[model samples]
Target: MDDGNVSLDRMRTFVRVAQRGSLSAAARELGIGQSTVTRHINELEEALGVSLLGRTTRRVTLTEEGSQYHANCLQILRLVEQATEEARDARRVPVGVVRVSCTSALGVMHLARIIFAFQDEHPDIRIDLNLTDERIDLAREGVDVALRLGPVMDDAMKLVAIGASGRRLAGSRDYLASRGRPARPAELTNHNSIVMSNVAGSEHLLLSAPDGTRLMVPVSGTLRVDHGLAARAALAAGRGIAPAHLWLIQDLLDAGKLETVLDEYDLDAVPVSLLVVPERAGIARVRLLVDFLVDEIRKLPGITPHRSASG
Candidate 1:
């Protein structure tokens, strides 16, 4: 028997036999005939010139030599599998589906455009966009990446901080015209505001001045809503003033439907981040999409890009 005759198949069969301790059981596990398993074991032993197994009518046990060889075989098989996967990943094309999760308002108002542009660039890559505000389990829901606002609490996820999303005090032109723009942050108390009930401390407004002065002003509203789109609609309807993310209302501001009130006062910014599943982060399509999203998101009007953060 030649050393070259020790094939991977034979080693696998031998390992299976060593694990199962029965030729018939190994055959069943390998989806092969018992004779085939026997031949592999015999050939493996013959090639090595060692009695690898002690056999009886009921069961087979690994010899000391077999025990050592089984350990080596396991290591070799694992290495082979890892190498194969690495090679495949290295050569994989930027194709296939990338499942993305984002908040509803951001998805509809901004992210949807970015996604459409991405698809146009990578015609082969398909997108499954899940627009929801819920913090979903990425692994359980099979999400490749998630774009979220605020802090991402999942330590298991790989995070890429796109930026801090800046907000401004804004209201529709008609509303500001009727109610009058607040000349100072304190004057906001006299104006009707559209508050986002979902945000923490929505009842109060925090503003920072260029002179390093911070003000905490209590705010009240006739209409308090939980979603961005609703707040936007109310603002467009000349409802009241509210702190709005720049990306959410940039178009309205451009069209003169909305105007920034108290532009000198800056509102607190929220962290915008991309959370990727650790396993999927290595895939060609997912990586490409994530990179594209980061670049695009950084270009948004009120985004202040930050140093990358990963876990």
Candidate 2:
């Protein structure tokens, strides 16, 4: 038998016979006839030009060369099985760690709940959520996904616009009663505003009229904070009126703790998007998680699905 003519089936049968110590027993385990098992072992021995087994009337034992070959065969077979399982898991199951980055306020107020629900549905996938106010390099940090407000700035990333949320001029009921409610956009300057120091253009409140007219009003306040959650806390404590994302304050509005002012002048809707490395978009778990987030975010109060994100 030539080396090129060696068969995997024959090698497997020989290993089984060596382990079982009897050709007939290996044949029974393999559900094959005794003659077929004998022929396989004979063919393998012929190909290798060595006697693999010392066969007697009662039992079979491995020869000196056969012992080393049997160990190598076992390793090869185990590796093949592992490779097969990995291939199946990649497509058929969500099994792996997915690292995600998100803004601190969004993560605490909304994203965390969504992730918890997602984990409940997919028990095999593990999520590591890193919440921060400062932006970080996703590739360097090994982050799998990121949820961010506004448009995708990195051209290298694959961007999917998940939804849109609008900022509203809001004040707590007690604050409004104490300071008097602003009947129009112009009156906001008279009332003290709790400004978010980290947000761009937080000092100006931009309002749009029904006929598409826009106004940029200068805003001032006694309290300034670095995070949105802190600003929200100040507002809830009746510190002053401030521009707030409706999604973040919907419960407050419902409970009458906060109320929107100048409802006639609507604020522009800001896009919320999911960002991922373009190459990772093809991964099964990444794709599934993106879809799940988009679906859930659209259902949030004051959030509307982006046209491109709508299926």
**Predicted candidate 1 versus true structure: per-residue lDDT over 1-311, tens digit per residue:** 68875988898888789877899999997999999998888888989999999999999998999988887886675456445545656776566678899999999988999999999989988898999978887764557799999988999899888889999889998888888879998898999989888888989998998797999999997899989999999999999999999999999999999999888888888999999977677777778899999999988979988865331
Quote the lDDT for 294 in model 1.
93
Provide the TM-score for each candidate, comma-separated. Answer: 0.70, 0.71
> lDDT tens digits, residues 240-282, model 2?
9987888788888999999888888888888888898665676
- Model 1 residue 83 CA deviation in Å: 10
Best by lDDT: 1
Alpha-carbon RMSD of each model: 13.0, 17.3
Residue 159, candidate 1: C-alpha displacement in angstroms: 0.7
Worst 10 residues of 1 by lDDT: 77-86
CA error at residue 210 for candidate 1, angstroms: 3.3
